[model samples]
Target: MGGNFLQSRSAIRHEVGQYIIRNIFASSGLSLYILVDTVFIAAAGGTFGLAALNISLPVFNFFNSLGLLFGIGGSTIYSINKLKDPKKVETLFGKLLLFCILLGCGFAILLNLFPTQILTILGAEGQTMAVALGYFRIIALGAPLFMCNYVCVNFIRNDGNPQLTMIATLSATLVVVFLDWLLIFVFNLHMLGAAIATLFSPLTSLTVLTFHRKNKQRQLKLKFAFPEPKTLLKAASLGIPSFLTEMSTGVSIFVFNWVLLKLSGNYAVAAYGVIANIAIVVLALSNGIALGVQPIASREYGKRNWENVKTAMKLGIQVAFGLACLLYFILVVFKTPIVSVFNHDHSAKLAQIAVNGLPLYFLSVFFASQNLVIMLSLAAIERAKMAFVLSLLRGYFILIAAVLIFAKFFGVNGVWLSVPFTEACVCALGFYFLTSALKNKN
Candidate 1:
């Protein structure tokens, strides 16, 4: 079990692909539950209910920042372990476990104390505030469980059992969907029921996975002692880029929600919710591909396999771009039909926005997705600062600037256009850095 894994490619490929497929099911199922949950709530309580859930989007994503500590830090260290040592892998994993526990507690405190204030800041309105606040508080109570779900799956993926990771995910999704129907519909629990369902779902999944370690040939060491002084910080620093990139995406959606709310109202927000649910499917598939490549990129780079690194970059981008193009055609060509599925009454402004926004959104999605992959690839190979910078540019700074500048002049339309503009600029920067890095080494 402690031996070299490179020569184990024949077995690894079959295992990894299975793992990717399983995780894909998990992402797909979870996304579907979420879409359905919002739809069910809307039918029960209307757009206020939908907007209430939308308001919590940022907070949910921000919790993901905490989970990423293990995803990037522990996983990267684990992947390169054969080149380093198993003991170091054990230590890193141990330290990350402690990190998740402490951080999850901190988030629980923060979220519990600030539900209404935070929702207000995210642009929840007069009527939306009470509903959003109630829904958020209920959901916030489960932050620890949610964070654990993230850390566990990421660790399992790094543990060389991607399939188990996927199953754990499916278990969570199945449980959540069933419980949501019971809690929300049968019980008339409404937002509270939905929130509780979300909370208990992942908790159940985490519990089910505990039994799988009995067959484990590879052992992950857990240390109860305080991590070596800088280990926590070092691991977190490696994880920060991933943390920030993803969390900032939450901020982007938060902003989009606000703009959409003012521009087209709650109907638009609900329509956007449906559209976002669809996009999550794309994001999920893209993520599965990223997971497959991350460990390979990390390990190969450690061995100075520049050719493989370059090839992986091309292949990764090729797959992502092709997916984006396919989605673009679907949304662009079938805009009315897509919007009609969710609701068609009143000739809603939201339907028009969906039709307009989908095409523009995908224009730079390929670039954005590919750029995200490159960022993760660099990070996996222990190139933290560069990855961090690229993440910053793509996830935050440049896009914010573009959105602010154009949105002021263009109003609602300006906001919609910001995505492609920001993404194209970010991709140029990624290419520049990659080119320069290659030149400098030569």
Candidate 2:
């Protein structure tokens, strides 16, 4: 019995590790689409360009958030039902895909028609408004593509094709990198060039995902089924935590942009732009670990294999913390160089603010990493309400309150500290929820 237990633990670890490695690479590559844009845009357009991109990011986040809402939600359900009811899983893919495409197109039309109003609400003004409009308009055209790609990626990964998903994501990133440089520099398209390049990311990712249909192991079929309101609501309910998780970033950015613009004007917002983009990559790392564990945990839970589910969660938490430590260390030690990479025009003010903010803003990662794993673990075990509550507290309620209170007391430094403070509080809440979930299950 002891020997079997040891072997079981090892097997679970190896399986979890495999998913983690692939997901980390895929998530990191996906994040680079925007990171690359920041770098190239910095070189071509300077601080204003960076600010404009930052202002427009919430829109991008909104697109991705909705996709995850459907993607992760639907995929989690699919994973649970894949073996139990394969036919339901088949219809799920088609229904969600169609709904996402139509929803995305609606957003595209609205954004294109009211670019200025949206940009202004997001804190764009004057030169920033002018620069943002071009990028925003071009990016709006790809809304359907973005939503579809996200939905497909999540479904494919859950369908037991993570390798294909990783390949698709990395390939898309590489293509974006090359095109970002080509369009921004070679064509001197600057902000517009970067936007055009970004459009290809989802296009490339979706194109590559098409090959999943050929995989002999494939189970999901894309047969069109009109989405029933009941089915859509079920998926959305499961996915709300994920939706909030992604939207929290956009919402936080919108609030931060507004506050920062008020406190110190464009340069401060520019400084924040630098720190926020880096945070995207860090959060992506944490999210990768969560996503890696999600499929395994959900499947195990569906099987009622509590021990295996626990094993996956434990491994995820350990990896998340380890990566968090390493990332913070790198950010602390190499802060200058990292800031410089985004500071092409070399403004002293921008560099100073970003350097100071990097360490403080990043302290949140430790808690944020664990929060992600805990939230996803809850969701995996079908604890959607717990996950949703945690998501709301950390991503919105606690964060918004922390930012306002901290900014009042600490000024700019307080703004930076708000994230860490919020995450720490959420970490406590997440632990309570996770404990309650396990106790109830047992």
| Residue pairs clashing, model 1 | none
Q: TM-scores of all models?
A: 0.88, 0.99
Instruction: Using lDDT, give the best candidate's number.
Output: 2
Q: Give the alpha-carbon lDDT of every model.
A: 0.69, 0.92
Query: How large an RMSD does model 2 have?
Result: 0.9
Which regions in candidate 1 have their CA more than 4 angstroms from the true location? 1-23, 26-32, 344-347, 435-442
Cα distance off (Å), candidate 2, residue 255: 0.4
Alpha carbon deviation, residue 282, candidate 2 (Å): 0.7
Mind giving the per-residue lDDT tens digits that candidate 2 earns over 284-399? Answer: 98999999999999999998988888999999999999999999999999999999999998899999889999999999999999999999889989999999999999889999
On a 0 to 100 scale, what is the lDDT of residue 322 in model 2? 99
The per-prediction CA RMSD against the true structure, in angstroms, equals 3.8, 0.9
